[model samples]
Target: MNDFEFHLDQFMLHCDAKNLSRKTLKSYEQTLRLFQFFLENECKVTEIKDVKSWHIKKYISHLRDRGKYTVTANENTKVYNHPDKRIDLGREISDTTIANYLRNIKVFFNYLFQSGDISENPVKGIPVIKPKRKQKELLDPMEIKRLLSAMDVTKFHEYRLWLGVRLILDTGCRVGELLELKPQDLDLKYNAMLVRNPKNNKQRYVYFSKRMSNDLKRWLKYRDRFSDSEYLFPTIRGTKQNVSNFEKTLKNIGDSVGISVTPHQLRNNFAKYYLLNGGDMASLSRILGHSSIDVTMKAYLDFTDDQIRQKYQRHSPLDNLKL
Candidate 1:
């Protein structure tokens, strides 16, 4: 009923019209609702026009001051008077977390300013926060081989697991994309598969290696003999496998090998190896289904010094020239 509440609803409607992903829409809704709660409960400002930069700054400071224990949905009611969501508490939240909250606020305010809901933009002067990058762990060739060799093909899901992991390494398709694949999506002859529903909601092609092609052929024969699921990788009940199950299986494998492994990590290894072996950025962008080359570059380009050194020797002009 409040001006801020009405504006927040309108902003969500705009985002929905733009066809933003459900996950993104949920995040935006949560962030904005939390802001609304803060405005009403903390600042006592029911009107959108009454909000100021200091109010926004105070909210930011409040976020930082809150300790880092996770607050459940019930706990959220005590602080924000908004039920049905949990929040982090206890230690100081990460720079990345604060940045995301600030970014959401900026977006909401930008919408309000564009729609003439507010005369001044409170988020205009806030500097963008750049979080410190952590070096991502990658599996080398031998480690990758060890994982593949450890798979027990006699077990049906492990067979699926083996092929699934290899496909990710070979093609860099996301685990969600891999799990969503159907039989018709594959083209073994071309050593490729069609990603019909990638993160960007666009169809893209990702190619596998000849080795992976062979594995797919074998798995297909075995799969047909066992179950009749439409999915490329299905469970014993002939239903699509859940991503959580895949992650759990991967974790067990990682524990056995003494190297923590994740689907994203495998995908990361694929990108790193692809680049080190002379794969182009534009192609990698398309293969990974990123919106732009810049998106792909920003995500997968953070190579460690050792990784850079390894890549350099293979491509060094002097070494290649054979002078």
Candidate 2:
């Protein structure tokens, strides 16, 4: 193997040793392989030391020209037969995806530089890709009610599904973290649930409402009847619930209610509603397990005009002072 290939393998081993998730490792592998292909053919650079910042810029331009969803191996060849149907022929991929690829590449080069293998990081010179922010839609109270009503509680999994959605709406937990929840993590009496495996790898407690507390009690009793698994939400075989399956189930519920909803939408709804009801941003940030209040603001601060108007009416200094 070439120097680049050998170094790539070593980096991957290091990543694996660090216990990085399979998904992250796969991304690193794929991005490096694709870049290697580009370097060998387009830039005609056989050695890792020969690569420069300009070559990286050329690669970025090449990616932009290829458009979205269009994967090129060397420089001229385009890949088809991808799994996602929405990926059209030579469509321009979203900035978010391109940003992800760039970010992965940056990480790879940073690792090489940090390990003293590389003299300097070329990726450090490249500016970060800032994609246009998309506003997340919030589910109205009526839509939420209809979604819950759509759940067929008579069925086992559907009953579990109902409880899962309600819990997410109540606690604003990510579906992955929610699925990771164990029975012991639940403190129904205290109206709190503990998230052990959060995205940030930090454990935190998120509270539920009194009404949700009662619902949790009911779910616990019902869950004990069938599932002996450690997970609060387990599949039929009692394994931890899959994220895609849960998303699909949520999509089905959304279809029944004539609204497109997602697990994240439920979390967003919780945060938005919490803020609309005089909740503090700092507390909400902590509750949502955000890295910082700024991160929370960047994501959840995009309230609709009507929502802004309502918040203004309630909190307007003149109105509150009653001059």
Candidate 3:
């Protein structure tokens, strides 16, 4: 292999050794490979040492101009079944996606510099690309109630999905973490579940409500009669449910009920409602498994004017006074 390809492989090996999540590793590889391809073809610079800040800037410009799904690192794999292929091709890529690509590229170059493979980091001077924060659409109490009522709980699959929705809403746990849960992970006494496999690779406990606790108990008994899967929520064949499958299932259910829903949306709603109901930022940060309070604040602090007014009314000292 060429020097560039060799260095890329080495970087990936280092990431793998560090036990990075497969999703994270895949993102790194994809971003690096695309950048490598650009370097080789557009800039005609094959050597790792030859890449300059200008080349990196050129790449950023190219990315802004390039349409989505217009190119792939592996041309052969483009024919394979993929979600991106299903979408309309050649649309302008989003700024957020470009920012992610830049972050991944920075990480790769930083690794090389830290490992002493490079004399200087080309990405060191590159300014961090902050993606524009969009307002998160959250489910209202009435909409949530409507979603729950729409589920036909008599059917096993529907009942399982219903409980899954409730669990995420109650605990604010990720769908992936929820799927990884075994019965043993649950602490019924404390109304919490142990999230052994979180996105950041840090384990934390996510608590549910008393109402959720009772529902879980009922579901567990019902689940025992049907499947003996070790996973708390599994497919009909007793296998762990895929995240995409669960998302699609939830989407279809939402479509039927005339509302849009996804697993992440449920988690976001949990955070929003939690804050709306007098929950503090520090505790919310810990509960959401964020690395710091700043991250949590950046995410949930963009409250709309209506939401801010509601919070102000509820927390106003004079309004609560009996005098």
Candidate 4:
């Protein structure tokens, strides 16, 4: 292998040794491979030492112009039947996605520099890319009610999904973490669950409401009759729940209720509603498994004018004071 490829492999090995999540490792590989392809074909620079800041800048431009899904690292692996194959093939790539690519490349180069494998970091001179934050749409209380009411609780699968949705809304736990939950992870006495498999691989306690605690009691009894799986939300076959299947089921249920919803939307709604109901940033950050308060603030601070007014009315000094 060439010097560039060899270095890339070493960086991946380092990341693996550090126990980075598979999704994170995959993203790093994809971004670096694509960058390497660009360096070789566009700049005719195969050596790792030959890459410059200008080449990286040119790559950013190339990414912006190339559009989404127009290029892949391995063309042979492209699945014809995949849903993403037809999605916005030539549409302009979002700045957020391009920024992610740059971030991944920067991380790889930073690893090389820190390891003393490279004399200079090509990515060090590149300006940090901060994409404009998009406003995340949240489900209103009425919409959430409709979503929950649409599920038929008589059926085992629907009941499971219904309880799952409620748990997510109540606790703000991620879908992946929820799926990894075992019965032992729950503490109905304290109205909380231990998130053993969070995105950052750090375990934390996520709390729920008393009403949700009662619902969990009911779900556990019902779940016991159908399956003996170790996972809290297992399939009929007594296996762990699939994230994609759960997502699709939620989406289908939302469609039946004349609304759009996803596990992420439920999590976002939880954060939004929590802030609206006077939850503090630090507590919210910890509950959401965010690394810092800043991360939580940046995510949920884009409140609408109506939402801001609601918060103001609730906390307004004039209204709260015994005037």
Question: Which prediction has the highest TM-score against the true structure?
Answer: 3
Candidate whose lDDT is highest:
4
- On TM-score, the stronger of 1 and 2 is 2
TM-scores, in order shown? 0.85, 0.89, 0.95, 0.93
lDDT scores of the candidates, listed in order: 0.85, 0.85, 0.88, 0.89
Of 2 and 3, the candidate ahead on TM-score is 3
Per-residue lDDT over 1-323 for candidate 4, one digit per residue giving the tens place of the 0 to 100 score: 99899999999999999998988999999999999999888889888888888999999999988887777887765765342666667899888999899999999889888989989999986888999997878888899889989999999889989999998899998899989999999998888889966446889888888999999998999899999999999999999888989999999999987998889888998999998999988999999988899999888898999999989999999879957
Q: Give the local distance difference test score of model 2.
A: 0.85
Please give the distance, in angstroms, between residue 303's alpha carbon in candidate 1 and its true position after superposition. Answer: 1.8
What overall lDDT, based on C-alpha atoms, would model 1 receive against the true structure?
0.85
lDDT (Cα, 0-100) at 164 in candidate 2: 91
Error of 2 at 68 (Å): 6.0
In every candidate, how many clashes are there?
A: 7, 4, 0, 0
Q: Once superposed on the true structure, which residue ranges of model 1 sit more than 4 Å away at CA?
A: 67-69, 72-92, 235-240
For 186-221, candidate 3 gives per-residue lDDT tens digits of 989999889966456889888889999999999889
Which pairs clash inside model 3? none
TM-score of 2: 0.89
- Model 2, 1-323: lDDT tens digits are 99889888999999989887766888788888888888887888867777788888888788888765455433433335352455476777678977888898888889998999889788876999999988888778888899899999988899999999998888899998989999899886787888965344678999999998888788888888888998888987889888989999989878977989899988999899999989999999999998899999998999999999998887899978999
Regions of candidate 3 where Cα sits further than 4 Å from its true position: 82-85
User: Residue by residue across 1-323, what tens digits does model 1's lDDT show?
Assistant: 98888888899999999888776888788777777777777789989889899998998888788644343223435666542243633668888888898898999999899888889998889887788866678887788889888889899988889989988988998898899899898998888889965345778888988988888888899999999999989999998888889999999987898878999988888898899999999999898888899999999999989989998998999989987
